[model samples]
Target: MGELVERVDERDRVLGVVDRAEAERRRWMHRIATTICRDPIGRILVLRRAEQHARFPGHYDVMVGGAVNVGESYEDAAARELAEELGADVPVRFMFKFLCLDGVGPVWFGVHEAVISQPLVPDASEIAWNAWLTELELREVVDRWPFVPGGREALRRYLVSGNEPARPRSAERSPRPAAMPPG
Candidate 1:
């Protein structure tokens, strides 16, 4: 038995509990809670998945999150994932929820955001590289990087919502390594 997740319908109504792997294998809808972390100065945190990650290996992601466990609210799952992945325990503001029908599978993605004030302790098993980038820098990277499909969609919707904070003129752009092809 692996991690258990609630199998849901298109309307996000819980049908029953299933192991996370079973849900994925059966193409059942499940909930994934994701959080976009930004610095106090508004730089978004981006991460490259480690090569050994079960899904989207060697891909880039703008959010850190995972499958929501059975009986967990989206908000609680978002906070838990942020802490598990980045070692940050900040308050997360729920942004929105949408059905993501990407190659990863159909999932109700609950998007959240937090301003992280503490240093990150990324789990090496999950994250190969991480950096804080201005929105402009992130945009450039997205154009060339093979990002995780669902996260890419989430970012697209988030950007369209115009909820992102304004970037200061003095915010420096960090140089990113060349993008690697997704494995």
Candidate 2:
């Protein structure tokens, strides 16, 4: 038996719990909670997936995340994934979610962002290598790198929105964009 994940519908309503493998095999919609981390100077943290990873092995990814466990809120899953993968216990702000049409199957991708102030201890099972790249550097290499397909789509949507995570005590409040309509 593998990890249990919530099977979701097109509107992201939970249908039932299913094994992660079963969900993938059936092409069932599910939820993935992802976080984009940035340094204080605004460089995005990017990492290469470990070669042993089951999905997109050795590919670069700007988003750090995984499947949302059954009954977990997107926010909680985002924070949990950040701590597990990067060892950063930071607060993450929910940005937006979209139905990712690309990749192995459709999933409601909950996107979040965090500014990491603590040192990172990358998990060997998940990250092979990591680096902080300026937005310009990331944009330049995004096309050339063998990036994960779903992550690439997330990044595209994020960049287009031009919204940054709110810093503590910042008065600026960006309006949340409506969820992307299912294609």
Candidate 3:
């Protein structure tokens, strides 16, 4: 079955729903949700997208997430994505949402964070590999490893918040106005 995606306007108001292919073909804005998972010791979880996947195949991503289906809330999507990709159902707290420019159109990206207490079992179909890295470790290899642009931006935002797993209320409620370069 084709995926039904929630379509939105420039300001992120819902316009209607469309199939994923049509949404991509028309460059329609749509919703996506991601979660930055951290181990109890504070190491962040990172994963590489499967090489066989479409869109930045084989690239590293800092979070586990995917497109929000029609009628699904971002928070629900975040949890669903975490479970689907990593087989971990950690309690994720919503961080923020921003309009990110992508190859097709602007994506209403909702980010969340959680400290995981259980071991993650990666789904091989979606993830090629996974790792838990400290802030310094991530910094050391980030420049050399190719990361998905939007995930990189989200990681940067996480770091800017003083390495906090969750975003501050002020920043989460109000993201910057400009379109973030997917770097």
Candidate 4:
């Protein structure tokens, strides 16, 4: 699920879409679009990849996500991911945008807030584990868990704004509990 596809932004101007492969391969300007999804208790959504995943296998990831499909709008992709990964149809609210050079490529991610947080049904082949955490706790875990390198800052801006993101905190749930496991 290397859905790190992004737009070729010429400083915030829509140039064109580039495939994740080309962007990563050529170090082109690109961004991994994602959504800051929340749970019923105001907890943010997190996901874990199955052991069989080719990349970042067995790592914990938080975000209702996927690649921005060709010809798809960011909001549409976010809404689609909410339903596909969380098993809920969420109406996306446009928030902010994060600009970061993911090292491999530049990401202009469109941050959006879902209207509601609902139970998830992650794609078995993609999500290994999933959970919800307070914004404070999200920062703490980023320090302890193997999160995507650029996720912390983006998560911070998207969730708590300028406030430091929660990291290196204990998890309220086990890595894989009775909850649904990433297939």
Candidate 5:
């Protein structure tokens, strides 16, 4: 059986549940939880997706997270994804949530962060490798390396808002620089 996920609307209200494939095919909004694993000194963990993965194969991803499963809360999914992708179970603090629109579709992403000093065991099937990069180092590669669009968006949002929620605000936001090409 295919994985089941909740279909949601722009406001994050669940419209219904459907197979993951179907949800993707129809371009429905869905829930996703992404986590930023930070080191004690403040560098963020990044993962490279396996080369054979269906989406964003071989691209660098800022967070270790995935679709929120049926009946699962975003926090639970974030923790589950952290363990499944990197074999770490450190406590995560909720940062903020945002709606992302990329080539694939729309997905609401919950951003969380955790500080860990433990070694990570990457799941070979899900992540090819992992590294901890400082914000400056990440910026150097942001445009040079191929990253999951949603991941880039989330990262940009996080950076712009200074770790706060990136929701639209009455205050005008400064225009952002163009992103590096997707490798």
Candidate 6:
């Protein structure tokens, strides 16, 4: 997670800018992150971030997520994160990318998803708790808790787009956009 940050536009698309200059010049250089959503008992898997994390500690996140490396693709990062954080081995499908232009701080939240193939055993070091949330329950949680701050917006966009996760595929590459570079 060395510096080499990324820059993006309002759509979270790469803006071909460097993170160091963005910060030194007071510009937004997005930090690439891979977000994963899962079907936990036919509901979305929700995880509470560990209190030890540097940002948004102890808050609720949709599922597995982490920063992207300087040269890694978002899909690979998401897939690795799923296994590293939850001991999951299912295929990771691509979702949409989220740009927090409002933060004036560049932190590109690259999103992905994978269906649950087996029971998840989330790593206690990275996550604190887990829950399965129906759409209604998700709405309530989004409305009530500050899940990712603009998480409600992200969820809404994801729901409206109807982007479904791809089943396990060992060879086929997902059409999902790649943002972060895998380590």
- Top candidate (lDDT): 1
> Which residue pairs in candidate 1 collide?
none
lDDT (Cα, tens digit) per residue for candidate 3, span 48-155: 889897778889888789999889999999999999988987788998787778544478889999889887789888998877766666766666688888888888
Candidates ranked by lDDT:
1, 2, 5, 3, 4, 6
Span of 10 residues, lowest total lDDT, candidate 1:
174-183
Q: What C-alpha lDDT values do all the predictions have?
A: 0.87, 0.84, 0.80, 0.63, 0.80, 0.63
> Between prediction 4 and prediction 6, which has the larger lDDT?
4
Per-residue C-alpha lDDT of model 6 across residues 50-99, encoded as one tens digit per residue: 88966577777675766565567878778888889988888876777766
Model 6 RMSD in angstroms: 9.8
List the RMSD of every prediction in angstroms: 2.6, 8.4, 8.3, 5.3, 7.2, 9.8
Q: What's the number of clashes in each of the models? A: 0, 0, 0, 20, 1, 6
Worst 10 residues of 5 by lDDT: 172-181
Looking at model 2, report the run of 10 residues with the lowest lDDT sum. Answer: 173-182
After superposing candidate 5, which stretches have Cα over 4 Å from the reference? 164-183
- For model 4, residues 71-172, the per-residue Cα lDDT tens digits are 677788888877776677868876777676653446666667774644467778777677666656565677677776556566766655642233324545
**Cα error, candidate 1, residue 3 (Å):** 1.2
lDDT of 5 by residue, 67-131 (tens): 99988988999999988888898888878899888946788999988777888989898888677
In model 4, which runs have C-alpha deviations exceeding 4 angstroms?
1-7, 115-117, 162-183
* Native-to-model Cα distance after best TM-score fit, residue 80 in candidate 3, in Å: 0.7
Clashing pairs in 5: 143-180
Alpha carbon deviation, residue 134, candidate 4 (Å): 2.2
lDDT of 2 by residue, 86-117 (tens): 99999999999999867767889999999997
- Position 81, candidate 6: lDDT: 80
